[model samples]
Target: MPAPPPPSAAVPRRRWQSRLSPTLVRDRCYTRSFHSAGLRPAAVPLPDGAVVHLWLPPTAATGANPLHPVLLLHGFGATATWQWAPFLRPLLAAGLAPYVPDLIFFGASASPAADRSPAYQAACIAAAMTALPSAPQRYAVVGVSYGGFVAYHLAHAFPEAVERLVLIAAGVCLEEADLAAGLFAVEDIAEAASLLLPQRPEDLRRLVGLTFCRPPRFMPSCFIRDYIRVMCTENVKEKTELLYVLINGRKLSDLPKISQQTLIIWGEQDRVFPLELGLRLKRHLGDTSELIVVKDAGHAINREKPAELCRLIKNYIVDPSVKYRDDRKGSWKNAIKRFVGSSLRKVDSSRPLL
Candidate 1:
């Protein structure tokens, strides 16, 4: 039998974890943001001993011609709240029933099982979403950074259920060769993991610099220390394991087999994965995928350019006829349809769903 889900308590913050800290304040704001967007928080238990905490619109997906279901998955560092808060209102207004889930070991979700692979994370989320009171027969997914890895697996695992797939700055096709080629600044996987899951304030600073195009010139050490203590401290072991599992023991050929109408969005100036990987992924995904490069942006493009991102997403999924300009000077560049041409046959893989 699976272990029970973890508890999420709302307790007062200690001096070291002050309420005034930006992280806490932003979290509070995200809560209000969700409420204002017609969404409320909920949780469901998965068979694999993990409880998934997600925020869904009050009007759940139901009935014939129901509102389209959209699942937004967040990456590392911050939980779903911080990463996805900007998208809630925009997507909801566009007639999408958005569901933002904190992957296992993030936010209110937790798992006692030793598994930390993206595949397991995808399975757990699939189970929780399907167990919803009014689950949709099909849904769309948008994942950024690490969440892109989970999204890729989720779409691959449930191809029939996922109607559309979107990956933003997700290096799903990265290989061991990319690391050796010095495509990333880190010396090795361990060094990359350390930088991403920083323990010290200085490490956190380095991470921020890499994540943002224009990181704050001066962040108070107190806030850095507090943020690190609150956000980057928990699930250290499991997160590190996740990093290894995602990067190592995998080849380029292992790229997820997905057939959903796909959209690949990337920051042209992305340092972590770089723009080259995005182009490579476009080639790998074949004609069904479209690539959009957000110019002058970095790895954290979702936060840096939320409105433009939302516009692109809205047009792609909601209203293709309603063309929106890439206000950030970004351009929509569809794939050149190199692999086997646009006549490629769809490939399907079978996996159990909740």
Candidate 2:
């Protein structure tokens, strides 16, 4: 791919945080990562009139291979760029075009409609892909946390358009009873909502503590407050509704009837969704499904263990022979062993045995 445009021309300036702020520097790095991967920003308007801003890989990134579209959906809290930055280059290198969409009410995406259900969110994403010029006949979706709910609904709503499904730390099968039973670290749904949709520094810190297995001990209150102001303050009502509809509106029985090949990835120490939910989802998805858990990680495995997540996703999407055992008690060592072994078998028939 050609060299990225100069910083001034390529990335728009944001004046909210000083350039020296850790957060702003990290944001710049994320944007640079996207540009390095040949992902340029674009926007699409959904049928419901909501607009989605995305970073899409350039034609050159896909090389000479026939286009294989893949959708990367971010969960609640942050934009698609923040969550999927690490995976873009790898997917592009693996000859897959990545479409990273910011869900409605997040980032540059917005829906004026009052509907906040997962199905509605899913529909908006499906419409975006369909609107793409020469849309892929079938695409794969990888969703993290709340995005997984959207992904599940997307597969169910448009199975004909989806070839594979990957759920990361998404608790699609959790029932209201699980919340009542203290399955989550929070006391109740209200507390959970408050933490997830935190408007205060303390609440944001709580969220970080739950999200990361090893969260930073001393994030400046000013940074947390600023992050909440810039990222978490938008569409607060609709976001809350999205959470409510997801946790209260669905049950295990209502899980989407997705027939596509599925992969369930979880963070072993995830406090938000817990590993049990991932195992349950794998079993519910039946024989065609596989579960891989990242050890020493938490709910934000995409951020905590990005390389492993990217490799697993790229392998599953590009390699037809990749096989993942259904292990509910998976660890990092086992996952590495399995992934390396699988990758080896694809190239070297006489490779050393694991």
Candidate 3:
């Protein structure tokens, strides 16, 4: 016989925990600079041996309200600079204190020849995050393109550590040959690596056209092109190899354990990964997750629609209705979430949405 469920059974929350999360603890502990000076860049230590290149923005510099602490992870073969430079202003305008980091193999972060596996990469990211100084250790992670793959893995690997997740133009779960080939489409690896390197203005312009809904004509030719000269790369071989490894890496079957709310951002015209992957991810993640597809955009959703993207993030930050919040932390509520979770486990597993 089925027993009656509690009034708060629909709400999901930890059975025995205070709302004063680790983030609150961190805020009480760390002496924040609060944008006392300009943007500060540093090499932060991770639990693993790798050091991550991080940019801590001035908290109050933009003359706006205090924002949430955000961690922005860039795509493959690119440095953290790629994220901080273009979108940092938008993020700041939205009242988000952005923390941009260069993954081990990509930016100024030291990556030894031996450090290669995707699991190791994810672990390193978690370790680096655990070491950062923030008011709340729980932060919103925004991963773009290749970085999006890592973002999902990171949230799954370290569930309690992440508060929310934002995936932009991430890749497919399947290991396709063409997908691997496309990653290396960049013109040069060495030039893509160094900040001092230069790229053609026209290439940037074209890229912007392919990425945004209503991008400026000069965007691709000017900003992106100038930026790419020093930033864009042709990291074909190793990046392809990394994708091969990550594609076969692991699946998020235990995603239900992740309490963080997830936001999927996709570009409708992004032929690289395509919209289906994002749509599939939303379902697999859970019903609480949301997906926002940008029209007339390509693989680079953030780069193409920075303002719109910023608005979406801000809305997410303000609205809790679309999030994964377990309102009641009572034992009865916990019992229901767990019971339903376990009962549906077998049935839902058999029902394939894809």
Q: Count the clashes in each prediction.
A: 0, 0, 18
Q: TM-score for model 2?
A: 0.84
Candidate 2: tens digits of C-alpha lDDT, residues 1-354: 999778786455444335646666777788898888787777888766788777766862344334667889998877887887877777878888888888888878888898888889899888877776646768899898889989999999899998898888888888877654556665455666788889999888777877888888889888887687667787887888877777774478867568888888888777778666776787688777888887888888888888888878887888746776434447434654544433211112121100
Worst 10 residues of 1 by lDDT: 345-354
Output the better candidate (1/3) by lDDT.
1
Q: Which stretches of candidate 2 lie over 4 Å from their true place?
A: 1-22, 60-66, 325-354
**Residue 298 alpha-carbon offset, candidate 1, angstroms:** 0.2
* Winner by TM-score: 1
Looking at model 2, residue 82 earns an lDDT score of 84
lDDT (10s digit) by residue, model 1, range 1-354: 976544433243254356568877878888888888778788998776789999876677333344777889998777888987888777877888888899998999999889879999999999998898877778889989899989999999988778888899988888776665556777478988888888888878877777777767998898888788778889898888988888886688977668877888987667777666677787788777877888667888987889888988777778533333344444344323332243212222110000
- RMSD for all candidates, in order, please: 8.9, 10.8, 19.9
In terms of lDDT, model 2 sits at 0.76
TM-score of every prediction relative to native:
0.86, 0.84, 0.62
TM-score ranking from best candidate downward: 1, 2, 3
